[model samples]
Target: MRSVWPLVLPVCSALLSANLSAQPTETTPATSAPEMPTEAMNSCLQASIPSAAATMTVAELRQGCQLLYEQQLQSAGESELQEQQVSSEDSTGDKGERLLKRRMTLEALNRANRFMLTPHKINYFFPASYTRTPNESPYRDNDNESLSDLSKAEADFQLSIKILLREDIFGDNGHLYLGYTNHSLWQLYSDADSAPFRETNHQPELILSFTNDWEFLGFRNVLNDVILNHQSNGQGGLLSRSWNRVMLNSVFERGNFAFALNPWYRLPESAQEYPGDPDGDDNPDITDYMGKFEFNAAYQRKDDIYSVMLRNALDGDNRGALELGWSFPISSNLRGQLKYFKGYGHSLIDYNVDLEVFALGIVFTDLF
Candidate 1:
């Protein structure tokens, strides 16, 4: 790592030299606010080291400081900032006004009522794909029509979005969020059919989160979220698939790593009335594949971030899913993401179907 001491010493010496040889300014009225450091260098120094000029006069900055004073002030400011892991407050305007403005700005930025989590940012269009369409469809059995009669094309696309409903309704620590995610397998290359959505799944969930910062078990406690989730394909009859669940999630962090554990209980559904019924609780054995709990772990390595998700039934029958993801910087506010999935529960329709999928897309936010 480059040492700032070399660069800082010379610069500080020059500034001290200049300050010791500068002239004083005329005194102003007692009620008038003093002029602040406004030059690029002065502003930067003040921002990085607020105490460096806490009691310095304009004349001192311009012509009165010696090497010893500058060194002491710089060391003190740097030590405090490093210990707190926070930047020094900006020094501008009158003391009271500046402090008030800073407080207001910080509150606005962190208000719990305001939108905290991002809603819809990850959406991508792909020109190639593969998939096994559902053998039975609700629309076909109910209406005596083929809902997915078309053949799978060589190219397809998918779209999804999420929304935040409420944040910190009770206080600064509690949050309520509503999210929706949709996935579609489109036959984009089928000119004869005009690109119909071969398979579409809709997922909506309501989640309540409570956050606290502390250290436990060598890890930092991040947040806890309780979720009521519903997922289904907007289909009916033999092809219908849907489920509801109540889940508990806990998140933790340690240095460059973030980890989460999610456990859920499936809400019971009314059974179909008759033996031939095709509707109620479509996939009763879904838990056999989807599992009751999942774990997510993410780590940052330099500019790239990697994440892994794992789920297991924990019963004698071995079944679950595993997903691996990597995200790298693509721009200032955007990141390119690549994901690979193996096993079941990739989607509601594929809850019981073993499948493998690889996806490349852009993510607007980092898990960090």
Candidate 2:
């Protein structure tokens, strides 16, 4: 599956779009509008106008025609709304159709290779990330006496992206995708230590995506994803941390709010005969802290977004994590992020250690 079209798809997402309201005009009154193209008018224009050596841009031409259409509609004292606008909600309160269709269009573009790569997760960097608990036992276990001091403050960032492998690979349902995500922690403030990267986790996944419309108690199920996932820290011996899992991701959306539930099962590996054994399970008790499932919710209020994540180990130890985040628009193309985390599994190297973290940064891509 990884070799299929350079490997693309990864997981789940459903996009949101706002309704358009007409701007106040000098002569005409308007209420609301949706982006719609006039097929007949476009066909007529193409037949009449000279195609070769075109001087006018498509936007200019479209704007002129749209103005004419609006004037005609206003003359009849009626408002025209698009019948196919995904933003339109039903009176029964069964929403998510809008978001569902929008996602379908995005996936269609991916299949067409027009937008092959898409954001799989929130991409952000915090140069001044502070963690109250820094795991130093690994360094101590390494016996590298020269590196004893581990800073509590560091820089952290994550990059996650996916590409479409094939749309309708199952003839109608499954859309295959390959995704890669990278997480890294850097000791940028430790200038005395030359600012080396402390740990980096690499994840590459295969996803089978399906569009769904199931609803229960006013909530709409918009997406379902079956994923094969592998993550590793690219280390050896006692420092090695790696695991593989089969995961299920189900996403739901209602109005400007979205939610996701992800559960995974770890694949078992052989136990080690002794410490630092080469061919044995690394971090065999990782699940005891990282948990078996995660839940995420995001709510968008105009240009600002608020999100929260929760996880529980579902065992006697009852270990897990909680992360809260806020993203506000800084400019037309920029957004600022503030995040707080209290829990375990901030990084693979510190899976067993609990920490409280606060970070402020800028976001390149965000959760929708």
Give TM per candidate: 0.61, 0.76
Q: What residue pairs clash in candidate 1, if any at all?
A: 19-63, 19-64, 20-63, 138-236
Among the numbered candidates, top lDDT falls to 2
Candidate 1 residue-wise lDDT, 240-271, digit = tens: 67777787777666654667778888887768
Best by TM-score: 2
Return the number of clashes found in candidate 1. 4
The digit string of per-residue lDDT tens for model 2 on 127-175 reads 8899776778887899744345778898999887777776666656777
Q: What is candidate 2's TM-score against the reference?
A: 0.76
